[model samples]
Structures are given as C-alpha cells and as structure tokens.
Target: MSFGIFQVPPPANEPVKSYAPGSPEKQALKAAIADMRSRTVDIPMYIGGEKIYTDKKHRLAPPHDHRHTLGYFSVGDKGHVEQAINAALGAKEMWAAMPWEHRAAIFLKAADLIAGPYRAKLNAATMLGQSKNVFQAEIDSACEIIDFLRFNVHFMQEIYRQQVASAPGIWNRLEHRPLEGFIFAVTPFNFTAIAGNLPTAPAMMGNTIVWKPAFTQIYSANVLMEVFREAGVPDGVINLIYVDGPEAGEVVFKHPDFAGLHFTGSTGVFRHLWQTIGNNLPIYKSYPRIVGETGGKDFVVAHKSADAKAVATALVRGAFEYQGQKCSAASRAYIPSNLWEEVKNYMIADLESMRMGGTEDFRNFINAVIDEKAFDKIAGYIEQAKKDAGVELVWGGNCDKSVGYFIQPTILKVEDNQYRTMVEEIFGPVLTVYVYQPELFEEVLELTDQTSPYALTGSIFAQDRYAIELASRKLQNAAGNFYINDKPTGAVVGQQPFGGARASGTNDKAGAIYNLLRWVSTRTIKETFVPPTDYRYPFMAEE
Candidate 1:
C-alpha cells in the first residue's frame, strides 16, 4: 500500500516563507506537512545524580521513516542498574527528611522547565521515536507531562496540609510523616505520561526513586531527566537507567533496599515480578509495596438510539489514536442490530478518510506502530482473524515494513462473540465489531465481561437515561475508568483516574491523590503536652 500524499520537509536551518493567502493548494500542502525540527542529543544511563556514557550504544531510529536516526543511546547492563538502585538508596535519607513544602517547590519547578525549553525537543523526540504525529506527540510529551507535574505539586501540598483533629481535653497532637525508603518505578513505552508518573508521584511524597524507562524511548526519557535537574531537584533524589528488561528487573527485585515497585506493563511480567518478590520474601527485611497497571481489552457499546456520527467518531479515535497502543484503547464494540448498518457505514467512511503516512506529515491521521515486533504481532492477529470462520476484514490488514513498522487501520466484523478475535485484546489499530439484537443487550454485556480478562476501560452510548444508568451500574466491574458519550483514550489529568481491575493489574489510578498515596508509607507521630508521671496509666493505677 502506497500513498502519494505530500511529504514533510526535512528540518531547515532557516525559516521558510509562508504561502500567500487564498492559495488553497499551497495552504493544503502546508497543513499536510508540519514544520518541525529534530534535535540530536547523546543518550546516557542516568545514575547517582549524573548521566553516565557507556561503551554499548543503541542507535535510535524514527519509526515513521527508519532513515531518520534520532540519536545513539547508551545501553546499561546489570552493573548500571545496581548503580541506579544504590543512588536511590543513597538519596532516600535526605529526600525523605526534606520538608514537604520544599519538595513541592522542586516538582513545580520541574513542571515549568518541561513546559519551557525542554518542550519542543521532547515533543520532537516523541514524534521521531514513537511515530506519533505532531499533535499527538505534543500531547504525550509536553502537555501530559506538564499536567502531571502540576497535579503532583498540588497533590503533595494537599497531602502535606492534611491534619487530624484532637478532642477539647486532649493534650496530644498527631502528625503524619513520610516513608524512609527507596521506590523502583518501571514504566512502559506506550504513553510518555507513564514516564512522568513513575518518578513524580514518589518524589512528590518525599521518597527517592530509581526509574528504569522503556528502552524504546531513551531520548525523551533523558530529556525528562534534564528537566528534573533544571528544576533544582537534589542529586540522587531520582535515578534513571536505560537497560533491557530481564537485567533491569533482576536488579530491581533483588535489591535489599528496594521499598516499592511501581510498574505498567504486561500481566505476565507483573505476575512474574510478584512471584519473584514472594520467593525472596523470607530473606527480605521488610515487605515491599507493589503497584502495577497492566493489559486491557477495553470495549464500547452502541445502543439503538445512539447517534451514528458520534459513535463513529468516538470509535475511530478511540481505537486508532496512537495506533491503539494505549491500554485503555477500545478493542471491542457492541452495536445494537437496529443501528448496526448505520454505525458500520459511518465508521468505514470515517476510516477511509483517515490518512496514513509519516509523523512529520501533519495530514497523516495515523503513523506507524512502535517497532517490528509489534508490527509482526498485530499482523499475525489480523491474519488469524481473516482465517477464522464468519470473520470479515472490513477495512485493513495491510503491512509495509520497507520503511518502518506500519500497519493499515483495520476493522473486523465478527459474527460470533466466541471467536478468538472478539475475545482477546488486540492492542493495534484493529476494532472488532459485534452485532447484537436489542433484546440481547444484557447477554452481550455478560459476554463482554467473560470475553476479556482485562477490565481497564469501557463505554456506552444511549439516548435512554435509565438504560445508560443501568448499563453503567451493570458493567461497573468492566472498567476502572468508565465512559459515557466519549472515547476511552486520552484520560485527563485530574478528571478521570486511570487503571483497571482483575488481570489488568492493580487499580492504582495515576494522576490523582490516590496514586501519590501509594508512594509513601505514612507514620503517625503523637506528642503529649505533659509527660506521663508514672510508668502505668491513671486507669491502670486505680485497678
């Protein structure tokens, strides 16, 4: 599959002249290609409050067009991971001792830095490394990070100010305090927001953190470190390492000083880490906190009275945004039989209008997938779906790896709910459509529940208020973040807390006060105005 769309120009050393007004073709071309420049920077494993250059180098390539080399990043082994853990442990004492007000200031400063000088570069890297289009990359790399930082700063201040009341006759005061240990934050590659969460939440609550970012996003990750440093964050307060999975996990799980593990990834990996910690429980000094957000098979339901245009727009954006890599992206949709044809026509027409090309092309509605492995995995699923009985590929199953990992935006119609395509989480630009009679709405809901092991996010569209409310309550267990008249992707910072229940891992909602609470272990400090005169209390002395 080839597209003849206008290509985005390479980064220019000087600004180009804008097209004259009333030139439609010129304006269209300009709109189709975003004016963006890629900045080259050396990537290093950050440990012990410093960036460490290593002998091992991994060349970073843009997924949109593999010809563009983002930069060379240093790969860390077990030794580097250990250094990061040590740094985090070393910083724990002072960081935990710092006043909450001071820590909050540092985070606020970091937010400012990210929004200022680092904004453009981080946004560019996101576009280059992750194949996100201009607007999408900006949201993930710039907007989301700034929002998270601001939210964290505000939440920490609230946590700091919370107080306990004392009775009128009481002569003692109670205070809540910070935890005295290190946190291990393991983030994923899908969303740059995860990058912010892994460190900021812990730092907000006065806990030092050792962060191991996904290797696929080393450039943006390094930029994140630079932002933190510029914000006057103390040395060794947050340590970052760029390494492969197994070696990094081993270091994190085996460290004697490890206090908590904050993770977002696969269920298999989460279970493995849980078991690893359990196996080593006998030798550990104290119980370590484990928090995770894993896989999802999020769904959408369209009722008979649903607006066809609204449903189509929601479904297309939800399933194809960021190439459907988000855990909360809708993978399944149930449409009532009466509205099935209209919904299908509207969805197909909208998808046809979607332009697929490189990230630099502003007109490109969808970019490439992350890497070849993901490309192959999605391809295999598509091929398997085609071969299944009564499964029809409505839009796409095309793959072109000559340039990068690009898969066509795909839509499938599954005749039976029992089909594997309808059941599993296809974390790609693929949507499985299931048609159901109005009478079977309840049965369809049950099928949805049983089909997906994941319960991360789901949505319903209906004109009937009672039906919508009933569906919401009935499918309450279906999603940690449920939606009505909106897509599941693009969760706002303070509005909707994100995460899932069951096999989707812990429901630790990111970007909220609840998430910040997970990073710290609270200690209640009680002080008496008058010291006890004797060893025993007055009541005990009378006895």
Candidate 2:
C-alpha cells in the first residue's frame, strides 16, 4: 500500500500552555521557548525536482507528553522511495562532475543557514518529534548538524587538494573519483545528526544521494532538506523519501543504480541486507559499498577505587540520555563487590532527583520514550525482570502513555550475568547492575564479552593507573569506543571516530576522515608523452 493512502489524524490532546513567566522552570526552558518563538514550517516530501504534499498526514507529537502535537508531516511510501532513487540516479552524472569547490560552497552555505535561521526550529522539531529533552535535542539536532556540515565541507576540500607522491622516475598520478552511481542513505530516528550525515557525506564527495529517513522523524528530516535546497543544492542532487524499512530496503537493495548503502539501525537488518546483497552479487551491475552502524549493548565497569558519585552520574546520564534510545546507551554496568553498596546508593539518589516530565518543562531531566510500541517493549522487559529470580527492582516500573509513550527511569540489580536482563539491550531508561570481585576483573570482562552478540561501546573506571591501563588494553577489541573515566555516548566528531565492530557495526566512524573516504572511489590517471612511435621495444632496438 502507498503512504498517500494512509491518513493519520491529529493528536487527541490539546496544546500545552506556556509556562509561568519568571518561574525557574521557565528559565530552564530557554531552548524550548526560543524554539517556540521560531516559525513553524510545513514539511513536504522532496522528489524529482518537486516538493510534493500528500493527502496522508502524520502528526509530530512530543514524546515527553503526547498531548502536544508539534506539527503534521507528509508521508511517502514505496512509490515515493522509487521515485527518489530514480531522481538521484538521474542527477548522478551532473552532480558528480560538478567542481569540488562549488559543491563544498553549497554545503558550507547550508551549514550557515542551519546555524542561523533553522537552528531553533530544528531543535524544537527534534524535541517534539523524537522526544529529546530541550538541551539534548538542541545539541544533537541543531548544533551537531551544523558541526557535521561544516566539518564535511572542510574534509571535502582537503580530499580534493590532496595529491599523490611522484616516484623518482615515473610520470604518473592518482586521482580520487566519485562513485559510478547514486548512494542510498537509510538513517535512524535516535539522533537528528544522523539524518544529515547520510546525505551530506556522499553529496560532499560529488555523489548524488537517495535518502530514506525514518518515518517517526520525517518532519525534522524534511526541514533538513529544505535547508539544503535553500543553500543551493541543485535539484535532484539529494532526494528525500519517507517509507517503511522493508519496502525501501527491497527497492534499494535490488536496484541497479544502488552504488552504496549507508545504514544505522538494528543488527538483524544489517545482516539481512548483507546477505541479500551477497545473493544479488551475480546479477548486480557493480559491487556496491555497504557501511552500517548497528546494535550495541554498551557497558560501564566501575572498580572499587572509582569515585562512586561520579560513576553513578555518568551511568545515569549515559543510560537515560534521549531516554536511552541511542545505540551507544549504557545498558549494563559492572561494579566491584566491595563498592556495590556505595555505587547503588549514589545511583538511586541521582535517579530519584531526575525530574520526569515533558521537554516543555525546562526542569524536567528525563523525557518519554518515542511511541506506544517503545513504551510497551520497555515495560515488558521491566515486568519480566521483576519476577525473575534474585532480581531487585531498584527503581521505576511506572508508565503513563496518555499523552505520549512515557516510561519511568528504571534500574535493576541482577544477581548474576546469567539473567536475561543483564545481557539484553533494553533500549530504555533501564539499567542492570552486576557485582563482581575485583581480582576477577578479567573473568568479568570475559563474561561481558559473551553476554551480547553486540560489541559496540564500553567503559572502565578505576583510580589505579596500572589497573586502568591493563583493562583498557584488554577491552580494546571489545568496544568500538572505550571510555577511561567518562560515558561512551558523547563521542566528539574529530578526535574519536565513532562506530562498533563485529555485530555492533562495520566500525565506520561517522565524523572521521575514514568515513568520508568510503563515499569516494580512487582512479589512476596516466598519460604517455610519445604515443609509442615505434612498436619495437628497447631490447629489440639494441639487437
């Protein structure tokens, strides 16, 4: 069925009233307030040089409290996805042939526009659409988008300027070229920054892109496209579509023009895509590039020497940021047996103080889960854990889905790693803690390695420099991004490349030069000064 045929209704709840003037919550709500003051733009699906509005509409509601509808978005389906891919294919040659400097300028302009006019709106859309708290949404959706754009522009310039070394007696040079065809970028809903990365990275390298954004965050994705268009990204260079995963994956994987697949989602989907591409290799026109960041069951290990308060705060924030929906969220934590009591006390105190409410309430720390399915999934996990043997529900079992999908911040103490709660990824504001003897730290690490099929992100905390160094080296291969004394989620773009290995991902760090290199193809150019005036070789001439 086409997306145009599915008409979503407006949210049932009334609009939220403005917070009281001069109140503490009001002051804390600065970002949301600034966002509300900004203009609300209507979103349209961009395809084949046109901005199309559909009769089918989807409401964008705040996750914290569903009562507030942010706006309505146009929904696109399978046909729409195909059209977008076709458009990207049609524009591939012209865009790929464009001067590198010119393309960089366009991207830079788009970055400037996002930083200027679109900042607040983008933040607000993220808060309402994805359910991020004001501060988190502002940084990820607004600031991070601008950062990625600006960084890519600079990186592209460097790529263009780089030259190959000349051999002592050879007159040959190597040149980097754009991919032969269009790239398909399938992004996730957890981070708005991801929405920008899928298209911008490829476009910066002169490759046209067909972007299939997550349905839940279509409004924000649409706004990002508008910003790009306004910045002079030519028609058809970047095409945006809103479609469900399976339908879109089918079209993208089977298409002849699909040059690359940039994905960030579940491991199962990534594996399936890999297998499907493998099966299609014989019939495929060319070898397509596959880059993905999949699932993660990140962990934080706290040694006896670690600061109990600091570890507790990092664990809480890392586990609950964006309601713990991120792939890098801390799902499991290991504590030394001797320090378990102190860490537990600190964690409980920190979590208890966390204000639970809508993002509109500035004082609120933890927001709601994305939707009803997410709410139910998390609730089911918590309920199961509660009844499991030797599992204590430290906090949170409440859920209020009236306004939006809301789940209380939950923590569980598991008697052992054998419990499902310790191994699985909850993907909510839920954390499972296990205590281990300090001397068996290595053994505990081994246990953690086998706990999940994923090996994405993990951290270790200790005051003993030698112990920390030993653990860091031992766990080096276990996590894609390892932390010394901090959380794993807030990876900076330039310094540390972000991504996981094994089932977690292909380890293609999003903001690094390595990631940008994947979007390009290398070409060797050689010119002969004299077009072989004689057919005979030098040895024959001497004879």
Candidate 3:
C-alpha cells in the first residue's frame, strides 16, 4: 500500500438511500435479511485471535421475531473476561509501538470494507438483532459506521499535527501518547456505529481494548470484528468478549492495569461503574480514565410562528425512528398553544398512516422494540397515561408481545411541563407534549431547561428569528446537540459532534477531535540545540 502523508478528504454526510419500492438497495437488503434468517451462526469469544467456545451457549433471536433462532453465542464467565484482559495487555506493547501511519491505514481499510463488501450483511444483522427498520439500519450500521472510521482517521492525523511552541534556544514538541493500559469498552444495543467506534477509537490511537458489546448488538458487532480482523488489526489488539457486566467488572476493574473505560449505556450503570472505579482507585497503577455517554431526556420546542407541518414531521421522525431508542431522540416537546391544534392534526395523521410490523417487510415504518422488557416498560407508561385524568392520549397507546415486542408509537398530551413523562428518560416510542401559552414563551423555555436532568439534545422550530435567537441564548446549557428548524435526532458524524453535559455524559463530543483526545495523554519534549556548559544565569555571571 502506497500511503502518503496527507490531509484526509473532507467528510460529508453519507447519502441515505430511500430504499423505496423496487430499489436495488432495498432488494439487496431484503435478500441479506432473508439470508441471515435462513441460517443460525455459531459465534465464539475472540481472545488474542483465538476463537474460544464454551458450553454455556446462548441463542440469538431477532427482537421482531423472538421465537425464531438466528444464531448462538458462547457465554463467558469471569475467567474468559480475565483472559480477554490479559490478551489486551499482551498485544499492548507492539500495537502501541507501531507507527501512527500504520494504525491509520488499518482502520481506513476497515471503513472501506464496511462501505463496500460488508454493507448489506451488517445492515441486515442490525435489523434482525435490534429490530430497526431498513432505513434506520442503513443510517446506523452502514453509513454512520463508515463515517466514524473515516472521520476518526482524519481526527487522528489532526491530533498528531499539534506541536508545542519553541523558545529561542530550544525546540519544544509535544507527543500524544496512548494511555498505558487496556480500555474496557461497554457499548449499547442502540447503535452499531457506536459499537464499532468505542473500542476502535482508542485502538486507532495505539491503545489496546477489551470490548464487551451488549448481548443484543453482538450479531452486528461480530460482523464489525470480522472487518477489523480483515483490515489487519493485530491479534489481541482489540479482544471481543461476551460476559456478564458485573462478572466482567469484578475481574477487569479490580485488575491493576485497567487504564480507561469507553462506555455508552444506561446512566445507572455508568454511575455504578464510576463508583466501582472510585472504590478501587488505589488498586490500579494509575487513575483510570472514565469517558462515558449515558442516558438523555432530550426535547423539542416550537415557537408560535413555526410551521405546523414542519414541526409535526420533526416530531414524527425524531420521536419514532428506531422506536425512539436514540440517545438524542426527542422524547418531550413544548409547543405554543396557537399552533397546537394544527400540529396535533398532522402528527395524528402521520401516526395513523405509519405501518408497524416485522423488518422483513420494508414497507413497514414501525418495527418491534428491542425485546419483551422494553415492550413492558413502555406499555406501563402508556397505560398510566391512559388512566390518568391529567394526561390525554393523542394517538397510539397499544402494545402486544405475543409474536414480537411491539409498542405502538404513543403521544401523551400534558398540561404541565413538570409531568413525570416529560422529565423522565423513556427510551421508547413515546413523546410527551406540553402546550404553553404563546406569551409565556420565555417561561416555557425556562421550564424546558429545568424539566430534565439530561442535556443531550433538543430542537427549536420558529419562523421568527428573534424567538429562535432568544431560545438559543436562554437555553445555553440545556442541550449539547442543539438544533434549529430540524429534528434533534440523526446527528451527522463530522457536522454535528454528538454528546451532552450534566447527567447526559462527559460531553466529550464524539466524531470530532475532542473525543479522540480523551484516549490519549500528552508529553512535552524540549531539545536544547546548544547546551551551555554552565548553568549560571546572566545575573549570576554578573555577580
């Protein structure tokens, strides 16, 4: 490979195919899904390039059709977790010592693999494993994963180019060194792009990783591992494991060499992990780095002058896509009373028009939620809203888990901004609406800011520039990913760096240099060109 020292091509959002009727991409996806459904794969724990199988085999099934077996994965215990950790440590020296250019090359190849050869299979796996429809699967598993891989290379090059200033007699330079120990990356089932990014980001910067993906996301994660191996990521550099969270934590966190954590999961789990690390802080060789992106109760707000149809579309797409599992999905909305009637009409029509069913059919706009637990949790909230006099059901509020876990896209109309549904992070196809007096726009903005502890993402729709400007200024720290005249979900890689402050996460801003910086530590080097034999200062010489 003739790789040259160069700047990366500017990143642009990956074009999304409509996957409309009779489209080639659509056909390809259907074929892929059918192909995956026809066979049951045997997945093994990958430690140091070794495929370790276990007697504790767990069957894999689609969330949309839980009765059918798609595959089986070997479940690991504490011993396997320890083996993964040891493997990561074993590969650390050579992987970290390799030239930066070589590291960049490997990931770059992986991106190409995802974009070209592995595209349909990975997308199909996401649909079957996570219950996402075709379009949702395309954006996440195919496009977003490619974006992360390519953009990370650019970010890595950018990080390397940063040099320190030099004084008159000496040249000063700074080295961005990878952290000394292995990273424990715990990813969620929501996004396959995140599953690939969390561990690969650190490895791209010369760090080793013990990656434990959510059991639900493992089908696609296994595909990602294949891409990585084909791209020449060395043995033991990024060991993939399938172990229980607490069991793995018992071994990894207590180990003396655990250097960092890359996590994107529930806030409760992140907090517990943080506390565990704190309690075991003295056992490690150094303070372990904790970079986590937890839960979010994101929102959307509309001004009185906003277009009703546009606002309605944003709500439908933002709150219902992937069944509102996105961390940046709009869960709550504050609408002006003047526009509520028209907006509500459009929203209801859209919900009524949407089709919900299995992922094998591309025409269905809505698919089942991840599993039975998610279905029950969401159904409980909908049932509460139906029973409560204070809340009115605007549209769908039904759930059935007989064949698959299906929760209808539900809308709850609330008079108060402080309603429990408005403040809580319900990762489901649920949207709560609070219509405020147009005159109380300022108050509503304040209420929206105070409604949730999370500040991940939010949107504002307004034809009035002054109102838009006001909300932007008034709700400054309210959201890390803020949108204007757009839905809050679907943050692009390079354009809208994703993360949040407060309870949402560390706000390191993934998809940019900020996130990559977290994986590295800095060292300053000063080279004196002409060493003075005497260490005396000018004043001392004069004396």
The candidate maximizing TM-score is 3
* Residue pairs in candidate 2 whose N, alpha carbon or C atoms collide under 3 angstroms: 66-403, 66-404
**Candidate 3 colliding pairs:** none
Q: Could you arrange the candidates by lDDT from highest to lowest?
A: 3, 2, 1
Task: Determine which window of 10 residues in candidate 1 has minimal summed lDDT.
Answer: 8-17
Model 2 stretches astray by more than 4 angstroms: 1-42, 168-170, 530-543
What is the C-alpha local distance difference test score of each model? Answer: 0.78, 0.79, 0.91
What is the RMSD, in Å, between candidate 3 and the native fold over all Cα?
1.6
Which candidate model has the greater lDDT, 1 or 2? Answer: 2
Clashes of 2: 2
Each model's number of backbone clashes?
Answer: 0, 2, 0
* CA-only RMSD, every prediction: 8.7, 8.0, 1.6
Model 3 score (lDDT): 0.91
